[model samples]
Target: MLEKHVCVLEGVMVSQDREDFFLLSNCGPKLLEQKGLALGGLGVASINIGLGGKTLVELERPAAYHTTPIFPLIRSDRKRRNKTTYWRRRSCVQDTRIVIAIEPSESDGDELDLPERCRVLKLANSVTYDRMEKSLNQLEKIVLPSSDDTPNDKFLPKLTPLVRVLMGMAQPSEKIPIQELKFFDDTLNASQKEAVRFALECPELPVYMVLQVNTYAHRSDTSTHNHNILERLLALPASQSGTKLKVTRVGHPARVMAHEGVLDATLEVKANRSDQAALAKDVKNELEATLDALSGKGKGAKGKAPRGAERRKMWEEVKALRKEYRQREGGVVRSVLSESQVVLATCHSSGGRQLRDHNFDVVIIDEATQALEAVCWIPIFKAQKLILAGDPMQLPPTILSIDKMKKAKNTGGTPEKSSTTSDKTGGR
Candidate 1:
C-alpha cells in the first residue's frame, strides 16, 4: 500500500484591527487579505503591518486558529440543553494577536478545511516577523518534499510551503548510538569504549569506521587495538537460530599480501601454460638482449662501459614491461574490496580510489576530531550512515602554514595541517 504523506505549515498571526474573524482549525479563514497565502495550498499568509511596513505578520496553520472557549448557557430548569462545544470566532478586530494552524483540505489542492474548533488556541503573544521568517526558511528546507507537480490554484505560487507539524517531534542526535558488547575480555579505554559503543549501536551493514591518529606510533597502536576487537567479535560462536557475522580488515599489510599472492599465482600459471612457450621465449630473448646492451656486450655494446643514458633507458623499459604485466592482471586492492565484508582503511586510501556504484551501509571514522572536515566527506558520501569517533580536545590536524593557522585560530576554526609520513604510508 502506498502511504499518503501530509504536510503542515504553522506560524503566528498579528492583526491590526479587532474585527470579527472566522477561524478555521484546518484551513485559513474564508475571507482574509494577505499575501503569499495562496502558495502551497497552506493556510499560512504573509501580511505587512506596523509603520513603514517593517513589521510583517504571518498566519501559521489555519487548522490551529480559534477563539476562547465559552461555556454553554444553562437552562432555567437546571437542564443544560447545549453541550460544551468549541466554536470559531465569526469576527475579530484589529490589534488582535492569535496563533494560526492550517492543513490541506484535500491532497494536492488549494482548498483547505478546518479540522476541529476545539483544537484551536489563542496565543498570549504574537510571533515576531523576523522570527517567523527564520522559522519559515528552516521549515521550507527541512519539511518540503521535492516534487514537480504544480497545483491549479490561481493564488498558489511557484514555491508551495506545505508544512505539517508532526504530533511528536523527534530531535536529531550528533553521536551514533552504540550497543554494549560482552564478548570481549580486554578492558576498553575511553576511546575504545566509544568506538565499541558506536559499532554496536550501528545497525547498517558495510559500516566504515575512521580513526585519525596524529602520529605514526599512535596510529599503529590504535589500529592494532581496533583489529583485536574486531577479531574477538568475529571469533564469537555461531548462532543456533540464523545469524552470521563477517568482518575483514583492508589495510596496507592486507593489500600487500593480496598483491603478492595474485602476482605469484599469475606468474606460475603463465609459466606453466603450454601455448605461451613461444611468447615466453621471445620475452626471454628480449630481456637478455636488453641486459647485454646495458652491459656493453655484443656489436655496439662491445665497447667500453655502458653509458649512463643507455643503462637508464634499459631500466625504464624493464620497469614499463613489469607495469604492463601487472595491469593485465588484477590489483590486490580491488580483489580485497570485492571479497571483504568490512573494509578498514585510512581516510586517504578510502578516498584515493574511484568507487563506482559502491555504496556502504555505514561509514565510521575513528579519530575524526583530528581529520580535516573536507577529508571526512569522502567516505561520508559513499555510505548511508556515518560514525565519527575522535576526541577534539586532543591534537588537531597538522596545518603547515603559520599564516593560515593564525587566521583559523582568529576565526575559531580548526585549520587542516600538512600530511605526515605516517599519513601517506597508511593511505597506501
Candidate 2:
C-alpha cells in the first residue's frame, strides 16, 4: 500500500495576516523533505477547478520533486482569499511551516481564468535535476581534454597522485615539511596530535593552503579526534614566508551558520591582486605585443580581429585570456594545482566548475561512508592526495525509489559503509 502523508492545515496551524500571503503549518513531514515542492499543485476553489475541488491528481512525475507533501485542498470563494493564483517557485520552507508564492493580482478581465477564486500556489524548481545535469555536462567536458598528440603526448592528461593510488597503480610518497607550533596543549590526546601531525607533514599537508581552492576545511573527520586539525594547522603557523593563510567557506546552507560562528569571511582577494604579484603586468605586456602583431586590420599574413558573427566570439576569447592572466596562481609555475597548499571541500561541491579549474594538493571527503560512490568519484580525480574520513557505523546515502530503497536496507554493495577501511581514514 502507498504511504499517504496527507495532513489538514487549519485554525491555529494556519496564518494569513497579510494580503497575497498564505501560510500553513503543523505539517507531519520535516522541512527538508518538502523543500522541493516547487510546482504542479492543484488549487482548491468554489466551483471545482480541479476534480471539482475534490481530488488532487499527480501524474507523470519527475525525479526532481519526489512525492511532495500532501497539503489540504480547501475550497473558498472569498475575495480576501488568495484567489486561485498558483505562484511560480517563489516559496520558502522553514521549520514546520511553508510560505508558498502567490501570483500578483491580475487585470479585472484576466481574473476570470482563476475559476472560483482559487489557484494552486507553486513556483518553478531551482535546485533540481537540471543542476545535477549541468554538473555532469561540465564534468564530462573537463576530465576529457582535447589532446593533439594522442598516446605520444608528454602530458597524458596528468592523473593526480591520489587518482593513481585509488586505481592501485601507485602509493602516496609525497611529503610536506611541518613548521613548529608555538602553542601546545597538554589536554589533547595522542590521536589528535598524530592526526594534526599527519596533516602538517603530508603533501598538500594541512599546514599550507591556497585561498583559491576551498574553505569547507571546517568539515573534517571527527571520529579520529581530527575535528580541530584544520584549526590547529592554521593556528600552528600564523604565516608561511610572511603571508597569512586565507580561507573562505562556500555553501548556501552553511553560509548563515558560518557567519554566526565567525567563520565566514571573503577569501583574500587582495592577495590575488595581480599588481602586487606582477604576473598581470607581464601578461599585459605579452597581450599588447600579440595585438600589435595582428593590429593592421588583416593586411598581412597575421590577421586582425574578424568581422560580423565571428567578431564577438573572437573578442570573447580575448576577454577570457585577459581574465585568466589576472587570475594566475601565486607561485612561479601557473599550473592546474596551486603551489601553496591543500583543498578541503564537501564531495558534491568539490566537483564545482571553479574548484575543478585547479588540481588540488589534497581532497579530503568527510563522512565518506554517507556519500554515494558515484559522487565520491567527482572529486577523486582532482586530488594529489585523497583522504576519506568516515565512520563505519553511520548510515549511507539515501535511495528514493521504494524498491531500490528496500534493497539498500541490507548493505549489498561493494565497499559498503560498513566496510570502511583504515586507508580511508588513515590520514593520521
Candidate 3:
C-alpha cells in the first residue's frame, strides 16, 4: 500500500476537462504497467477557483497532442513479445498521458495525498479487476501443478463434467463415432481434422492454435486466416457427433467468428453500464460549467462549485438514466442468452455473476494463449466439456509486473494450467 501511494501518487498533476490526470515518466515500469486514471475514481476533489499561478496555470491549461517516448530497451536488436508503446496525448515529463490502453491495480488505490486544492478523486483504475474479482470469488480450491497421482475422490463435482475432467478428475473417455461435416469445408488437413475430432470426442482437449488472432484479424477475410475452426466445429457437432445432440459453440472469435459461414446467429454481450454512467456524469459537470460561465461567472467560477439545487437535479437525472440502462441490459442479456445456443465473447465479456447457474455442454476458448489462466476459468466453470485452441509461440499472455507474477505463483494467481502443461492431464 505504501509503495503504491509512493509511486502511483507522486506524479505531477495535469488538469483535464472533468478530472485530474497524473503524468509519469516513461522510464517508470510500475507506472507504465498500471496506467491511466478513472473518472469515477474522483470521489471528493476540492480545487481553488483562482489558483492559476506561474507553473500551476501551465499544468491546468489545455495543450496540444504529442507522442510518448519509447522506453529504451536493454537489447533493442533482440525480439521482444511487446514493443515499446507510445500514445497520442500531451505530457510534461517527456513521456505520456495515462490513457485507457492499460488497466490499474486490483483494488482502489490509496489516496493521492496532494494539497486540498490539488487533490483529485480517482475511482478504481479498471472494471477488469472488478469483474475478475467477481469470477475469482466463485472459484474454490482450484489447484495448479496438477499430477495424475493426486487424490481426486475428495474433490466435489461442482463444475460441469468436462471441466472436472479438465481439472484432472480422471473421467472415462468415450469413443465418439464420426459423422460427415454439416458445414465445415471437407478439405481440412489431417492435423486440423484430428484436432476437430478430438474436440468432439473428448471431455477436455488442448490443440494447436488456429492462426494469427487479434483485433485486426477480425477485419480480414476468414478464408485467409484459420480462425473459423470454432465456427466449423459448432455446426459439425449436430451431425458429426452422431448423437444428433445439438452442439452450441460458446465463444467465437472470427465467420465460422472470422459468424455466418457455418454457425448460426451471434449475440455480442458486454457489460458497459458503468462506463455509460460515468460519461453521463461528465456531461452533467460540463453543462454546469457552461451554465456558470454564461451567467457572468468568470474562469474562476468552476472552482467554487456549490453543487446547489440545479446540480442535485442533474445528478438525479443521470442516476435515473443509469438505472434505465441497467434494466435494459438485464432484459436484453436474459432474452438473448435464453434463445441463442451459440454465444460469442472474449475472456471476461460474458456477464460474470449473471451466468452463475447456467452451464453449457461445451465451452471452447479460441486464442487460449492470449488470456491469462485466471481469466479462462470464468467461461471454463460454465462448461460440461472444455476445448482449448492456441499457439503459445505466436502469442502468450503479457505479464506487466514481474513482482506480481512471482507473488501470484505463491498466492494462487494462476488457478489452472495453461495449454502447454494442460496436455499432461487433458491429453492430445
What would the per-residue lDDT of candidate 3 be over residues 1-428, giving only the tens digit for each residue?
Answer: 22332221112011111121233322243343345321111111221111000000011212222322112111111234433321111112212121211111110111111211111122222333334444444444343323543346332225545555655666656657667644256777777777787677664554446554354323322222333543444555445456532223332212233345433433321222233334334443453344343232437765453346755564454344434433544454454456555555555644343454466677777656555454566677667767887655543433333344465589977622221111111111
Tell me model 3's lDDT, rounded to 2 decimals.
Answer: 0.37
Ranking by lDDT: 3, 2, 1
Could you give candidate 2's per-residue lDDT for residues 1-428 as a string of tens digits? 00110011111012111211322242222342364433233332111001001111222212234322123223345666543432232222333333222221211122222322122322222222233333343333334446532556432235555545554556656766567743356666666666667765665323222121223333333222232343444564455588655443322221222233223221222223324546554664454343333332233625343445554454444455445553553232233124345443445545443454566556776666655443555666566666666555554433223333244565774322322212122122
Instruction: Report lDDT per candidate.
Output: 0.36, 0.37, 0.37
TM-score of 3: 0.46
| lDDT, candidate 2, at 321 | 46
> Candidate 1's residue-wise lDDT over 35-112, tens digit each?
211111222233221111111223334333223311111112124433332222111112233322211111111111
Off by over 4 Å in 1: 1-251, 254-324, 331-333, 353-358, 406-428
**Which is the winner by lDDT between candidate 1 and candidate 2?**
2
**What's the lDDT of the predicted structure labeled candidate 2?**
0.37
Better of 1 and 3 by lDDT: 3
Q: How many pairs collide in each candidate, listed in order?
A: 43, 11, 12
For candidate 1, the per-residue lDDT at 187 reads 61
Model 1 Cα shift for residue 173 (angstroms) = 10
